[model samples]
Target chain A: MAVLQILEYPDPILKQLSKEVTNFNSSLETFLKDFIETLNSHKYCVGLAAPQTGNLQRIIGIDISRARKPHLNNGLLILINPKILEVSDFKIVREGCLSIPDFTANVKRAMHIVVAYQNAKGEAKILSTKDFEAHAIQHEIDHLDGVLFLDKISNPASDLFRRVRY
Target chain B: MNESKNYFAVFVLGTDSPGIVADISKALFELGANINDSSHTIIGNQFAMLLLISTEPVYNTETIQNAFQIVTQKRGLTVYTHQLRHEDVYRKSSEPGQLCVIHLYGADKPGIVYQVTSLLAKNSVNITDLSTRRFGSESKPIYIMYLEAEVPNNIDTRKLGSDLNKLALSLNVEIKYELEEVASL
Candidate 1:
């Protein structure tokens, strides 16, 4: 069991573009497991990326099960070398990143998204997500491309400060 | 510059214009005042500004209260100043759960905003953000109200939408629910 340290923003590692995982072997398997463990170790965190833990690879881990939330039905979805095929109508979302650590941004995302990627078994697969789940997938994908949620926000007037309410 | 000194909370309300923000900031700035944080908005014809500013209290609330009040009255703005305590500096814990915005617009009449907000109150929905205004003329008035609310987890969006749809028919108003992403800092 490996719990990787989350790298915060302004760290050059977080800005690095993640490379595609060409070889899905045993080493990749260990990385995926460690990513999931690290994600679960944090409080109220539902998703994580390879770059989040200082790895510059196109690997993302997601799990949206919330103990406090009732309507959410989400689980771990690992995407390696993922690509967004199409996006539905644009919808704005409030999102905070593990990379940025403190500030949250009003990110605009597609209501529905179709993504093509490789699964854990190295088999190519495609999936479609809508609403909150779609927003999550896009967020992780942005990390793989070195794009943070702050980059996607439209208006700074709506930007917020003070991480903790004071 | 009174960079490290006492903090004061000032409440100003009246007709809003471009110079209102600049004038107040200019006065405070020249007096070596540092604005810690502030949030103000214009609703209808009135602009309300609440500022948390810090400056060396030359004499507590009575110090600049008279001078600023005179200036405020001359500018046609109502002003109330207070010496901020430690308790007043921090905001209390806000309501939990997701914040959503509901917008309603249609023919204006009695009991539109009242009936809509009353239904929300009945459902234990708290409106954290609200801005309402009337457009058009006396003969054909149009009412528009935008409300940001905190919705508990137990409620389903589909049911809420359906209920709102039913209410729209009875009230003769159009309503839309936009799940505002409030968690975004």
Candidate 2:
């Protein structure tokens, strides 16, 4: 497996809507493997989306197990054509994206979420997640719709902070 | 143009008005000055603005200040401009640390800001953003402070919290603090 390059902001590919992953062939498997490899390359990256790596497909990988609070995660999740069914409990948390390095903004995200999607083998799956995991899933799904956390900021003057360093 | 020699820190303060920002920004824009960084806020009826600006080398601090004389006169604003020193030109990037938010509030009293800030300074905590407000009824005024700071790696957050709690007890105020987690997605 190879680690793919994550496209940064202002890249046209990052702003375009990702198409559905309809093909469940070996090519799809290969892309998912490379996506996981690229995600694991970073020390604390908890999630990644297809558009982030220049693959305009509805796919995402998330593993919040090694995140801040390990006990509150679901180990690893690979979703294809994911759709959020229901969300509850809204809260604001600071979020930074791999595509938009060096900046973080306070974004309001749902604390609990129910999402339905397909697996790599084209099997339907439904998962309910809360807290950080839920936040990560929502963030990744936004990439499918050409949305960035920057667009969700309520107050740019006070909510945006320049990260010290990557 | 030598941008390095033409950097300045500009401060504007006066009664709050609708067109204050537009008027000041228009003046700076017409003078070919680029605002690199700025913070503006309104407290009650007063407005305060702090900006770091850069201009072409030919425009010195006096030239920029004179350019705003008309706006200052018409708007009844107090303006101050100072050429940035070499050390002030570039702010040193912050060290990786535990970022935390501290909230303090209670009955109005003296030495609240002084004591809290002094304790943080002694512990090498860097305050990045701070805002204080006096509210509630005038008969029973309340003081509230919210600040974000970076605690160096060497410091223990538990110990810092305990110390702050003790200080809060002595000052008869309530203090709450939590780590500001920035999720790297």
Candidate 3:
């Protein structure tokens, strides 16, 4: 497993917005692979975004393959320029971030979503998902827009919990 | 950056009145003691102040306590100063595993949280966060307690859910458990 350096909180790169990928090429492929490698290295991490790693490109990798129940092993998806087309009902879920590694906060998110984006093959597609899948997608998308979960936290008092694992 | 210094806690109690905070803070500033953390609140007819202070070059708690003797005699207040060792500081990471919210609401009664959490603790579950609130009328008031706990891997929630279901029936209180998943970024 490749051990990539993780960016911590208050890092300028983590706050910078990502640029949309216009073309699917070998460089994009390599970045996607490295992203997967870095994510796997963090056993506790379920996903990663491009801006977080200083790429500044609109790319995100998520592998909820091992998630509970039968889930789509999409393994890795490279969304060049994904946009949310539809969202249904807000759902509250506690979320932990790799950037803010030691803290967990409750966040309200879309229960279901339909996203439009371009695939690695340069083909455009739309995908719909709910539950954890939808939540993960929305989180990565927020990172692409320079938004952290701390930004999306609905109620600061109800949402944020300090890491005090003893 | 300067060298790390030790901290102390000062306890001050006097009759409920204004100017307590100003008076205490003024003394600390004059003594060159930094207030790292503090909780000053009035409970009942008395005002209680607990100050977590730090001093460079480490000052004596007795010195500070003695300095407050004049205020104590003047206002009939009780003042105490205590030094804290490194062991006194509690710093640790939060609980791991799946953190879930448990909401219990029922008629005003004792031992609601006791019975529910007693079972959870017996099963090795840890409570990371908790809060409670009371509402409704006095004659028919409702006691509502909200608790957030972490579920360890060994304990599958299905079993806990079933057990809680049985307890809900016995206690006649509504209990709800919801998973709190960490979202990736």
Considering only chain B, report the TM-score of each candidate against the true chain B: 0.74, 0.90, 0.66
lDDT, candidates in the order shown: 0.75, 0.88, 0.77
User: TM-score of every model?
Assistant: 0.76, 0.89, 0.79
Native-to-model Cα distance after best TM-score fit, residue A111 in candidate 1, in Å: 2.2
Tens digits of lDDT, candidate 2, A65-137: 7565453887778999999999999998778899998678889999999999999899999999898899999
DockQ scores of all models, one per candidate:
0.29, 0.48, 0.45
Under CAPRI classification, how is model 2 graded?
acceptable
For model 3, residues A1-166, the per-residue Cα lDDT tens digits are 3456778879988888888898688888777777778887775566788777778988777667644334554655667688999999897787778899767787888988999988877799898877777788888889889899878776555677766444
lDDT of 3 by residue, B26-103 (tens): 778888888866767676789998887888755788878876766677678899888887656434634466777889
Q: Which one wins by TM-score: 2 or 3? A: 2
Better of 1 and 3 by DockQ: 3
Measured with DockQ on alpha carbons, how good is candidate 1? 0.29
Tell how far residue B3 is off in model 2, in angstroms: 7.9
Candidate topping DockQ = 2
- What does the lDDT read for residue A50 in candidate 3? 79
1 or 3, greater by lDDT: 3
lDDT of 3 at B143: 85
Give the range of the ten consecutive residues with the poorest summed lDDT in model 3 chain A: A66-75
What is the alpha-carbon interface RMSD for each candidate?
Answer: 4.5, 2.6, 4.0
